[model samples]
Target: MEERDKQLLKMIRKQSEEGMSLLIDEYGGAIKAICSNVLRNYDAGIVQDAMQETVIRLWQKLSQRFQVKKNLRAYIYQTARNCALDYLRKYQRHSETDFEGVEDMMQDVSTDVEREFSRKHNERIVHEVIKEMEEPDRTIFILRFFYYETVKVIAETVHLKEDNVESRIRRGKKKLKAELLRRGVLNE
Candidate 1:
């Protein structure tokens, strides 16, 4: 939370429209990126829906909890991630049967390229593992790894009070690592 962020919070708390606009303008790209990553496998409509939900959540929560010492982009990233995750969970429940053959289908792909091909293939496996993650976790991993958002900002974005964000990130990392290991993409 820099002085500028504190000022923004004050303005937002006062319900200043300009403050809201500034917040959106500054943080929108990061939010969209996280949402896009989390909902990568879903339709574009769902991804857009998730992004809107995340922005709405940020608007609703910002005035009450935003801190000047936090990173705004990270907060937006986490929020986007959580919203994406929630959407995915509901989606999975509704389409569990449709996803039944996913594992078997993944196992059947065979390519003759080794070395560079194997590396690219492993990268694809990593992407698939990320796609399989439940919403917020998938979102969080992308924000933390792909975008390099700070934990403090991530906590604020997700409305988790910092410590929770750290814990969630740790767990998310472990889960991703395990998934990669299971795919034989990571060495023990």
Candidate 2:
């Protein structure tokens, strides 16, 4: 760990206000980026909401545990990812989605029962598979493929070099494709 990371841990373990402030100041941008990427389909308001919830959860987790088992940044990244997914699930199940709902997704899709069911099922599997992926790759894959976000936008949002983002996306796509093929979900 870096010197700053050790200090941050000390401050967190001590439960100091300045520590929380510093933590948010340092990681807020990354958390927002993750949430924004994860909730790309949603409006800004939902992204902001997810980001706020992520910070709160992080604060609570640190306050309660006072000990981090792994790298702090990675832990925060995972927290943000899980928090955004939870928000996404909650929004799907409960939020009013007249503007962008299941209907919107299905609007252009075929009406074939077998194809539709298989597609949705495979999509769910893909999501689950993506969730199980490691950091950076998971975020990169979702931002690139699922959201169809531009490489520049993803690089800026995730604070990675544009070429790095592209390479990661390439590898992520290849990995996802292999996994899907292995699972018999991807014919090609």
For lDDT, the strongest prediction is: 2
For model 2, which pairs clash?
none
Q: Per-residue lDDT of 64-168 in model 1, one digit per residue for the tens? A: 765534565556667788999998887877777686778775565454334558877988998888888887777777767777677876665566767777787
TM-score of 2: 0.55
Provide the lowest-lDDT 10-residue window in model 2: 94-103
TM-score of each: 0.53, 0.55
* Candidate 2, position 182, lDDT: 91
Task: Write model 2 residue lDDT over 88-116, tens digit each, in one string.
Answer: 99888766555556766677567666787
- By TM-score, the best candidate is 2
Would you list the C-alpha lDDT of every candidate in the order shown?
0.76, 0.81
lDDT value, candidate 1, whole model:
0.76
Error of 1 at 52 (Å): 1.1
